[model samples]
Target: MAATHDVTNQVPDLVGHDVAHDPALLESLHRHGAGWAEAELRELGVHAGSAKAQERGRLANENPPNLHTHDRVGHRIDEVEFHPSWHELMEVAVSRGLHAAPWRDERPGAHLARASKLHVWGQVEAGHTCPISMTYAAVPALRHSPELAATYESLLASTRYDPGLGVPAGKSGLIAGMSMTEKQGGSDVRANTTEATPTDSGGHVLVGHKWFTSAPMSDMFLTLAQAPGGLSCFLVPRVLPDGNRNPIRLQRLKNKLGNRSNASAEIEYDGALGWLVGDEGRGVRTIIEMVNNTRLDCVIGAASGMRAGAVRAVHHARHRAAFGSALVDQPLMRNVLADLVVESDAATTIAMRLAAAADRVDDPQEQALRRLGLAVTKYWVCKRGPAHAAEAVECLGGNGYVEDSGMPRVYREAPLLGIWEGSGNVAALDVLRAMAKQPDSVEALFTEIAPVEGADSRLDRAVSEVKKELADFTDAEYRARRVVERMALVLQGAGLVRHGHEAVADAFCASRLEGDGGLAFGTLPVGTDTESIIERARARF
Candidate 1:
């Protein structure tokens, strides 16, 4: 999170999915991906000739563009900035961190190294660090990179970094916002004490130290500050200009619990320059869009952790030995293995569905649902999924804890989700708030997925009973834990379906056809496997 340190390596491009093609995806995002249930943003009047807008547009494409290359070398400086005449660059970094490969890669060094650096150094970053903050930077670039749609998401995990930083083209253009918890905030946002004051220099100055800034050393920051009107956000930059030259200060980084790769920081601004995001007191809502991204990302990151862990467990289980038998051969172990498979699939499905929904969610109300779904998913997976890894560890006995085994690493990264972002309590409140705002629509959402989660079946009859309990409850607060638990199961099931292995929805439908095997295809009216499995299970019963 410092400035003036030497950076020698070029970040690696993300390793999966080609994001530059597929116009068909945008159409789908509007339907199921973004989910249009939320109210719409009334488009503001278009000013074709507004000089300020024109200047912004013109500069947005100017040379040296808006990439914050200094962050690469900003890891060692510790000076205060006081100049007031710096020019704003019309550019931002376009890299997506958690969703991108090399960073999200879960390998030995790259991801761990980057995340740890951010953890320890993020405080003085002078930029954004968390997944949610990164999405702020991606929005502008997406304006010009329409072709990057289908491929530009880390929404499942956390918009913790800029998408322009993801893959294919992640070298430049990054911007960040600091929406870490306020003092009255969860994960400690409530403890925030940053203030924005009108200065004699005519530019505002921000003075505060926040606990969690997702990315700390980028060029620009969208920061939250307290004022007479209440909480407001400001566009703060890391620059000090004396007359015509600009200089910046890199402050401090946080030592985080898990995502040792993405840098989360605690920052202090001593009269750093800032511009209000909207009107006075309007700063809080202006950046909710950023938090919404984080909510969805929490789901994605957790799900990704589940998948990575499952894959490793699956691989290890196949080769491991137990009591002179292959570990996978034991019936009890198979159940554990199946549990791993099922949960991983469920987690992935939830993230992908929400990711698709996020792409099209223009309405705040509707986005609230997507947000709740994602938070619940992330919270549950990040919280419970690690136990599955531990189960695999038990399957491996002591070897699982060995850092070299890959199991320990996944275990390490998985738990961080619950602590970072909003954490479970924060996410639960977020979902509760969403449910409270649109009780009926929220109920409808619950009803819509209940059958999917608990299909008319022999196995899920109990799950159906739980859904009924959710439906009968009128108070979101009353049903908070119950609702979250059920929704976790719902998303857990959905996550299973989005699997690279095949979906869980089909698997549930397949259960109707083939009870215990967990099939991938829907039941056919003609029923071949359905009929046979019915007979086989009937014989057992």
Candidate 2:
């Protein structure tokens, strides 16, 4: 090889490191009462950062799922074929209990433990988590129907990945999907035209189309349709109890911009059998539990992406050089890296806090806080993901724009979280709705922030601003985003002040809450402790 061909300046491959070595994440895990799972978290983190797992992630996306609507014999099969690596990734996720296991676990902080693992392992691949999240979320919704929950809850929570077309009763474990959005309805699920006619067997026959049914290969789906009473939620199985295919038809797979490894299809339920989930005409109320849980995962997913991007940016800067100095040593690069770290830390802190709320279902305050906190956090955190990812990519210069750097995948996956569960407007208005309907949620948010009332003046002022915004509902719908953004920042600032590292909390308060920073990332104020902030975000071997 020629001397010119030497790869002297290139950064080494990031592998064999603990992805869970994050300070904010670990601290929150212990503080939230899941300290016992630290060893397992670290072990999973090692695998998440391994070269083999990285390759699997890459391959799963590179070879996206293929839809086969029919068999060679002209029979309807409606199967989505994926690369072997997809199954490999799903197997690891299921075996580690990242899905529905938390709902059934008797231990405290089980949800927090699951959230921690999802945040860590999600870095390997974001697409596979789609089905995993749905499966985890489906449990709560299933509990709405006692008989159905009794039949499927245990299998859904089982740590076995059984991938095939089979009756739910025969499968060792199950994956679940949600089919709510229709062509005309989108976010307004009440506009759905799917029809569900009651049958004598205590089931309903669904006849309609779902515009976006993610993870179509799952064994079951929770969908919405209009019955005789009104719009209602129903559980539709892929294979019926008598070992026959349900009448659900695969229209075609969506050509999505990202999350390619997960198959989202436009499915037609042609007289598919379904069991009612809740009271008639209360479809939204019944499925809202699943939506909330998945929304929490959306926040966790965004935070995971931010962490991945920040750590990769830091790793690149530490090795790659420019102008006779390592990129990490450069002042401006330090500012950018530290700002990214601050954002990542803030997101991680809030995400863990929400998961802690999930663990305390019996506590009204925690539940109320989660009701309002999840909405605003989901809106702001996910809304910030794309910009955060873009800045992280730029930290790697030209290398990050390319496919192999893995930054492109991170960048692409960012926007999907904001869109999933609910879009920005939907989430923002949901906060307002929660305040109006569940007023306790409003007080709960303030109570959560009260602990750090005078800890940071900037945070205090931000909190006051949020209170004022809430007071004046004049065009509140129009100003929903603004109100929600401030709410999210105050909540994040409070969490950081209460639990995050000193440098992290200070940076977040200064830039995010006080508006001391510029529009883009890397614009933190001059006195910010860039080094300490960036150090905490670096991956450890």
* lDDT tens readout by residue for model 1, 169-273: 231333444544644555544345677787776557677766556545444556678766777766655543333112223344445444444445555676667
lDDT of 1 at 15: 18
TM-score of each prediction? 0.61, 0.99
Name the candidate that leads on lDDT. Answer: 2
In model 2, the runs with Cα more than 4 Å from the true position are none
Model 2's alpha-carbon lDDT is: 0.95
